[model samples]
Target: MMTDLHVVPARRGRAVRLAKGQAIQIINTHGQQVVDTWCFNADDMSEFMSMEHLHATLQGIFPATGDGLTTNRRRPILILEEDTSPGRHDTVIAACDVHRYAALGCTQYHDNCTDNLRAALGHLDLRTADCPAPLNLWMNIPVSPDGKITWGEPLSKPGDHVTLRAALDCIVVMSTCPQDMIPINGAACTPTEVHYRLIA
Candidate 1:
């Protein structure tokens, strides 16, 4: 493993560049935590991982092991290599932003996934606008037949993890979601470990 970083509990995050053939693993050191993740083409920021593209390719609602994620243009981006969790991840939910907190009456500055992602990507010269919908690893959001979405705690257990291989050179940005107000992250936020290495 070339890099191993521990994200502090709630509202903390990190980002890194991975060459083609490299892989990364997001570990749920403690269960009930959701990893808000983003992937972007290293060569062109405009070409990023697209959830809509994945859904179409998979012909299913969620991604499975061995399924490949693609960019907006349908170019290959990442391949799901390993999944220790139930694979009940999410792609439809937008990262929490300032406006969301404001609506919750916390007008003051608060830690959020949207801002955390930007902070992690800051060194790369990327902005919040460059971020797209993330793959909410270990998150639990179920949609009913009536089209109502209900959020709940993660279905993952402690030590569960998911790994992804870079189909193309890209950057991985993520946040350890600090959303204590919702049950998307077990109603409490905690630290998680992100591990990466060149698979060769």
Candidate 2:
């Protein structure tokens, strides 16, 4: 049986935290919102997250149940407990920075993903000097047969969400993407919410 969950809407430039063992549900409240996420060991910031290893363990392009999110040292960070919407997430697209903004014709939004990372790091009393690559969740990015990835349409609707349980003491930093130059976070930037609930 699925449990009834509460929903939260996190606007652009906002940050939220999810404790170990608790579940964090990221919802695209306004449809087609891209949430860039970075996970690190709260106790040790040097130990960062690695997406290449994570994808290898999953044995698929996207994450699903029985898949383990591993760290740089190949340690299991989080297990994919549930994926309400699969085949819609992109682990390859790194977080947008100032350079990307300038290249993408949106230099005005120079402080996109970097700012969000700083906010989340500040909340955890961690330093942002070493911002790691992020995991783009709920964003529709498809790789063509020619081995090229192009930004696709929004995969999530107004209420679509993805849930995951923490496998360790992890510090999750997410940015409800405010990218307006592309259609990843919808044509217009919107808010998203992070809901937490402990499993008994």
Candidate 3:
């Protein structure tokens, strides 16, 4: 069974519950918006997806279709079941926060992925003391041989999506990253909404 498409409003976040074996198809509705994604065990929030452990598990950074998304405990929580884009989802960048915006010269508070995750979880009456580094869906950060990283615009076209299948009962949280000072989302430096739906 497939549910109706849902929107993760621009510059905001959304969370969903996924039973074991269920999947979520997240759409890059406008083509270039980066969605910061996180997953936590429904039974134990502390056992959330860990990018560091994932790097060791996969022996690489970018997780493509068929790759197991591992948790802090080094077990599969979700698998990248499908990807319609160029398979450039980033795993190295930390979710943007007020400090990040401030470094970019923001004088006032700005919408951020860190806060977005917190608020999203709050709606579900859940909390996590740590904001684990997210799996940055569609974020294009090119790495050079010298280990330098250059923020590149997304290469995905409108409507491209990735299907992530859960291997454990968990909560999936997504945040349409609100970074506008740089062009990670797109060359336009504009953030936009993305869509998602649950699938059996």
Tens-digit per-residue lDDT, 1-200, candidate 2 = 23455443354344444567766665565667777877777677777667887777677667766677788778877666766665477788778777788887764645577777887677656775666667787878888899898887676666666666677777767786667677776665543454433342
**After superposition, candidate 2 runs with Cα above 4 Å error:** 1-19, 107-109, 187-200
Give per-residue CA lDDT, model 3, range 1-200, as digits (tens): 99999999999999999999999999999999999999999999999999999999989899978999999999999999999999999999999999999999999999999999999999999999989999999999999999999999999999999999999999999999999999998989999999999999
Colliding pairs, model 2: 8-193, 9-192, 10-192, 10-193
Model 3 alpha-carbon drift over 4 Å, by segment: none
Name the best candidate (by TM-score).
Answer: 3
How many Å off is the CA of 36 in candidate 1? Answer: 0.7
- Order of candidate numbers by lDDT, starting with the best: 3, 1, 2
- Superior by TM-score: candidate 2 or candidate 3: 3
Sum up the clashes in candidate 2: 4
* TM-scores, all models, native as reference: 0.90, 0.83, 0.99
Estimate the TM-score for candidate 1.
0.90
Q: Per-residue alpha-carbon lDDT of model 1 for 1-200, expressed as tens digits?
A: 54645454456878778899998877787778888888988888888888888778777668889988878999779898999998899977888888888887886888888888888888778665755888888888898999799987889998888888998999988788877677787765544444333444
Q: In model 3, state the lDDT of residue 152.
A: 95
